[model samples]
Target: MPAGEVRLVFCNAPDRDCAERIARALVEQGLAACANLLPDCLSIYAWQGQVEHAHETPMLIKTTAVRLPEVIGLIQALHPYEVPEIIALPVTEGLPAYLQWVRGQTLPLDKSA
Candidate 1:
């Protein structure tokens, strides 16, 4: 069953410090309820028409649809690379209590921002 109770955003950073900074920014900005940082990840991809490889940390950010755009803009402004990967997945199924908690944590996004 499609819950549509929450949203999951996948974000990656070059290292722990970068991930931490991003996480803090999201939380402080009332964007994410929680974020998990996984480090020591090896990634290989094509960038600038060349193959690139690097160690990175991935973050699983839990938030709501209302705050998504702000999250994207913040990441783009803060990320060091020219292009960053930021993908969002709808939470099809989740415990209702947890989903509610996520909603409670993120404040309503201002339309003017």
Candidate 2:
């Protein structure tokens, strides 16, 4: 894979509905090729100096690095949390064909220029 061509974006939502909505939006907008939502995760963290625990859905978004900014922006807009976690990790190694498919899926269908 080309350097920075692929990335795995991580985000957390308060509930399953929110996770599904966010994931669908991202994939529909071509910001992500796919999103795998993991539900019923217990997240324990500190916020505003208080320890908090909540059930969260963790979404793994697959997309290109080129589309990361737009992905983050969309997640921020749609997420309900005051500080939604959005992080991206570069995909250094993967099956070549799958990586290519991700690149292709993220491109706009209308290629006219």
Candidate 3:
């Protein structure tokens, strides 16, 4: 539960294709260890001046604190939405080996263990 041990970056896309693209890019760039896409998510919120409901594909991006800023920047640059929801929540508890793997995957090749 250290302040920034690991982060789960929550993001949503209008469709599966967009979600997949973002997930793949994050993983390929080492900004995220992996991304889990949850399909058929229903979101109700107010955009501009009216309440709206939409089906979205939510992505949970696994990464380390050291890689958070870069990950956010990448998502911002590639996301289709004018204002994508990129929320990072700290991982308070998880299997040690799994957390280690996430860190390893997100680190640069030359810096990985």
Candidate 4:
């Protein structure tokens, strides 16, 4: 595990459509190498000083630290909620090849600057 290199962002969507749209955007923008949709997620939380409950679609996004900000920003812009749940947690360890593949998949095609 490399310091400041891995990130696991957590975000939930009220509907499957929103989740899928976000997932497509993430992969297309190179913000995430892949997104696993967890359907039938039972979420219970408090909002606006009240208890809330709903079935949401959780998206498990796999990306690198460098692209996390961009990914979050995109989600925020498209997310319907007034305050979307977008948070990134660092990955302490992962498969070497898988991590490298994610990084490589998201890297800019043009290396020259």
Those runs of model 2 whose alpha carbons end farther than 4 Å from true positions after fitting are 1-4, 108-112
Predicted model with the maximum TM-score: 2
lDDT, candidate 4, equals: 0.85
Candidate with more favorable, higher TM-score: 2 or 4: 2
Best by lDDT: 2
Q: How high is the CA lDDT of each candidate model?
A: 0.86, 0.90, 0.88, 0.85
List runs of model 1 lying over 4 Å from the truth.
1-5, 109-113
lDDT of 1 at 100: 89
- Backbone atom clashes (below 3 Å) for every candidate: 1, 0, 0, 0
lDDT of 2 by residue, 1-113 (tens): 44339999999999999999999999998888999998579999999999999999999999987788889999999999999999999988999999998898787456677
**TM-score of structure candidate 1:** 0.89
Identify the runs in model 3 with alpha carbons over 4 angstroms from their true place: 1-4, 109-113
* Candidate 3 residue lDDT tens string, 5-100: 899999999899989999999999988999999866899999999999999999999998888889889988888889999999889799999998
Candidate 4 segments exceeding 4 Å error: 1-4, 108-113
Model 4: residue 103 alpha-carbon error in angstroms: 0.6
Clashing pairs in 4: none
Model 2: lDDT to the true structure: 0.90
